[model samples]
Target chain A: MSQPRNREQTEQRILAAVGEVLAREGFTGIGVNAIAKQAGVDKVLIYRYFGGLPALLAVWGRSGQFWPRVEDLIAEQPDVLTLPPPERLTRFFSHFIDALRRRPLTLEVLAAELVARNELTAVLEEERERWGQAVATLLGGDDAALWQDHIGATTVLIAGVQYLLLRARKIRRFGAYDLHSDASWDALKASIAAYAQATLVRPEPAGHARQDKP
Target chain B: MSQPRNREQTEQRILAAVGEVLAREGFTGIGVNAIAKQAGVDKVLIYRYFGGLPALLAVWGRSGQFWPRVEDLIAEQPDVLTLPPPERLTRFFSHFIDALRRRPLTLEVLAAELVARNELTAVLEEERERWGQAVATLLGGDDAALWQDHIGATTVLIAGVQYLLLRARKIRRFGAYDLHSDASWDALKASIAAYAQATLVRPEPAGHARQDKP
Candidate 1:
């Protein structure tokens, strides 16, 4: 029992070191030697326990703390599903942004994902897909159909939130919004709610559907 | 005269080589040694001619090739301003997406911008700001006011296009749309047009303006 407990503690330390290195130096600093140094352990232990960097990162990604879980999205509003679709979207984005803003490590990984396609990012993408699927499950049935119908618009709004939040990690402002300020985020959230209300409640008229000229 | 002409040719070769290296290996491969090797020139020439990597990237960024110019946005639509606001937006996004899609190097830089904030991305950001200012000037007066009124929504739509386009460089699908497929892009563009039409034409009612809970 003592031996197994010791091994688990060492593994936990190694994982914690990955977050520290990632926060301080971004993905470029992630390596067995660096993590082992940060964890205050022998480099061979990392290989023996986690196999290698790829496997280590896979384990790290699987750790629920890497990205926001579905619980985070609905933490404040326990009866989130009881709200109207527009209100649900508003709360969802508000919670989503708040959750992401709190996690600097996740922001760093998201920024890195835009440029690099290494094992770390690959693992993170899988985790993001899982998170997305879980959210879909939570919004199952009628609400899911509504969002799916306007999938393109829904994707754009969510991606916009992601891009701006990721941009906030590096720069202060994007367009009119100061990413660091709560006021700007408030306005952004309102706009998203308004967009959701407009899109979900009323479908675009057929005659107004404009097609690009070939 | 011959000396100056030879120097000019060498400089062009060096700049071209930056693009080559950037496309092949992303921003991480950008350095004096690699660029010099690719250009088949002495490393000293990179410093003497362009004043080193940062200056070289700066000049390269300003070379009218790093990103799409305002001209690219309105190339096919000289009478774009005469159209309605929604039509102008539709045309702008269509042209903008097409221009970006045509320039693989620009997409590479955009992706790199999200992760790393090196000299290359810094120069590119300045160029992007200049291009944005130029677009703003073109859309000055009434149209500008209209866009400003719904700036948050407008930013989200544009950022969505950018994020999705950048994602397409690495992954094939994002949500319901296949990033590589034209049909998917058509759907995205249509959604943007619909969104622009909706937000611009109607202001949210006062009673419906939902403020997030404190």
Candidate 2:
């Protein structure tokens, strides 16, 4: 027998194998045997280390591959919560769409969470709550009644974007937007930004100080 | 062998079985043998009659159960196309949401179409195209550039509503919207109507005659 891998190495190998399966077989190919074979580890290791497939998926989601990673981003920016509401929202959704575009696996995981009522559904809920808190902070401390409506509408828009992009993976043009073209992508992002501005831009009274609370 | 039923009866039985499976086991439970067993018919009959599972789903989708049957609705109200675009869109989406709320199976089927690249996806595309054309007529014929944006945005909204309702079947609340309560439901519908009106409403020249044609 060959030398055994350390715990960190084994975890990394398993996670990398999950990405490999996602790359080769798309969403439908995710399975325990497939992941183990790809990782060159025994299938029992997944149960021992990660508990099960759902936990494994949840761990993979929090890994560097998937995002909104809002906490980490905020840790970097530190004042992202203090920008003007509209600008803050624009940055938030732009980062969101960027992360979504960069990580197809995240979308697949989200799609699975949407469909299946499993352990990962709770993970999705917790992650969404975190994102909601971030947006609420940007929307003026959650006391504004408008934030509720904003969250509802923005959630719909986000879900819609996720569905459209997921479908765009197969068919390019759905309506006015072309998913494959850069111009169309820019137009889509611009439309989203405009939506953010339209929905979240609240006029301040003249000479009102900008709220930059830490 | 017993006396054979006519083609219509067999088809109806198969279709009814599909709904039974959908109602009892949800979207993922649908398969050839299960449907055939539920219908009390040979599995070969599925291929012989409906061509296959996807074709069966497509046929079931176009059946009386699903919503936004615009052709049928138009036949009932010959002048619906002549209404103000905003009012027409509000009514259209209200009806759309009502249909969605009434028919959970339709949402399940739609969710399946969203996730998997199957025959149902093509069916969904064709159905969406038909619905888009109907909406285009309401938005003032096919030439108006605004209709494209309207369609794209409305598509996103419709997809979002579908996703939300499907999730609401399990989790009651995600963000600020409560999907189960009547007050929340009214608020949700109001928001959708507002969205529809916001997206479709446009100023026209005074004395502009509303377009109406077969």
Candidate 3:
């Protein structure tokens, strides 16, 4: 193989190894030596290519399972934007949940962010902002206050879903819902979708007193 | 101090020391020797009295700041149960946030639960069930299905608040909300409260169609 091709392959191997280790052991297992061992590459190569573990993990998040699949969803369903605000949000929530569920590493990385601050957090924040902008646009510039409120609500909703799933991995069951079971998962998604749809509609400005509307 | 009295004093000192260590160095700083050193107690006593660090931490959670204060709030405001569900929930959210803020150690303990499983998590889980029962009572036992939906929604709301505040300790800001500031925190609490109230009144049953009401 050519010299440059070998370097590129080495970098790819390191990134892939990071994902595998992240899946198995979460953020705790993503040390420099572990990545090198998993990749079967020299330790020097990790530093030479990625600079450090934080940067490497961030790269893995950006290029690995989560974002790539999200991008494809957006590409495959370009007309998702044309749907009503609530419908668009429901679709987005479903896609986002599926992505996180498939790539458990994403959820682990998010859990790690709660305890520690690193370069990876910035990437997470930026990706969150991208989704925020997408959701914000769904309101279509009607009532500024309501738009802002829904944006904040959306942030909480996303964080809530992620946190519940993270805990579900450990505790298995909370309240009457069984996180380990498929039926409960489907119920969770449906309930959140309905809730997201309802939150965006602001018939009344302040009290949400219109909440009893049939 | 007499022998039994001395033993009681040592246990109290050890529990207080755990809080100090949790606040100062976080869960990573917590260990058998470190607690003994901080409390000026013997390592043998910690094992003898509390059985281990996990049990000690669990004792601290049950006796120390957060849950104890919350129980007082419930006790002090006997009228809280009689008020409308929305009012009761808002009050509960406010008190819960205050308890968390006042006892930053509780937040640290919760963050620790994310990475490690110990006796502390079981205490946390039990506390969660207590609150869940309280919220369920407010549903008035009218519709079983609606009750379950609200239970799930309430779980998400609590998790969202906890996750945001946990992240605030590290990242300081998320989206447009500043988790560290009073104004932003109040805004978050109010938004969640309103969202929670809107969720319970299931006028349309399936779609939460009343959500758009003023």
Candidate 4:
């Protein structure tokens, strides 16, 4: 592989190795040494690729590596906001969900993000607010309530999924990854769309939904 | 105050102080030294009352220290499960939301927790999971799917509220404390109840609901 390709390959190998370790050994279970050892690379190389273990672990948690593929999947679906007036909200929500199903890591990140009670929640809050603002603009409501409903629905769906995963007695018992499945992914998308449609169509406080933005 | 009463009073005072710090300073902002100085209690008392800074902070977060009286207001509400069977879900959801509104800390804690990104989230996930499971049990369908939906919805609502709290100019924004209004609270309660009713009364397939314990 060329040097650029070589770098990509190395980073990919490391992340994959880290995932495997995370699978085998929970978040607290894996360490720099173990991840490096698993990838058959030196610890220094791991540092070179990722600032350190916590940083690497956080990246994995954020699902950054998974977004490109998710974005592609989202692009494959019709944009929910692009439809003619009436259909815009319906189509936008439907396709937004379709995109969510294409990436399991998105769900994983969301599950962790919701229950975050301490210091780490800042990033989660910031990410959702950013998305909420975008969604609010699309929904054509005063940014406040629109973002609230949009972000709230998304957070609960994630928690609900995580709850199910635990009820299945996988992660709660073993701290293991749920073997990803198409049925679950589809369900997540459908539920999200259903919730969003319910949200957008619902009557808002008078004058609130009539924003100048969208 | 009697010794026990005095200690309890002291503990409450300290917890309140910590809450004030967290509200203003964020998690990393407060220190044992600062809390001691701000609280006007001997520094050693913090360690004595709550083992360490982290433990004390957890108490502050969990007890609704900053916003005070939300849980009390919620506790004052009639238990939702006691209502007519069909109305129980609505009542329960409404009551829970009333509690959330009364305690805006529900949103603040959630936002702060996402950023804290430490053992804090682990603690929150477990705590919220238990609360969700309890809500599921109260609803008609306490099965895995219902559990998923109830928990998921709750998580998302909290997230949405947090989204509103975050100053999102690119999207939408809501004044932090001011967003809580009786009418808005009523709407929130209704929305939550409606969503939960839809979920608990007619849960979809496991895969579709994306039910999993996080």
Candidate 1: tens digits of C-alpha lDDT, residues B36-71? 888888889999988888899878877756577787
Chain B TM-score against the true chain B, each candidate: 0.83, 0.72, 0.75, 0.55
Best by DockQ: 3
Interface RMSD of each: 4.1, 6.6, 3.0, 10.3
Question: TM-score: which is higher, 1 or 2?
Answer: 1
**For every model in order, what is the number of clashing pairs?**
0, 0, 4, 38
Task: Give per-model CA RMSD.
Answer: 6.0, 6.2, 5.2, 11.2
Per-prediction DockQ? 0.38, 0.28, 0.43, 0.07
True contacts kept of each: 0.50, 0.31, 0.51, 0.05
lDDT per residue as tens, model 4, A116-161: 3322234445555566455446554334454454343443443344
* Docking class for candidate 1: acceptable
Candidate 2's TM-score on the B chain: 0.72
First chain TM-score for all predictions = 0.83, 0.73, 0.75, 0.50
lDDT at A125, model 4: 50
Any runs in candidate 1 off by more than 4 Å, and if so which? A1-7, A137-145, A202-214, B1-5, B137-145, B202-214
Sorted by DockQ (best first), the order is 3, 1, 2, 4
Give one digit per residue, the lDDT tens place, for model 3 in B1-214.
2234577788888999988887788887889988888887778888899998888878987875454344554565776656555556677777777767776777777776676678878888788777656556644433446556556556666677778768877887776777789998788778877776666565564454443222
Backbone clash pairs for candidate 2 read: none
lDDT, candidate 4, B142-209, per-residue tens: 34454454343344444343343332211232322224345544554555555654444443364333
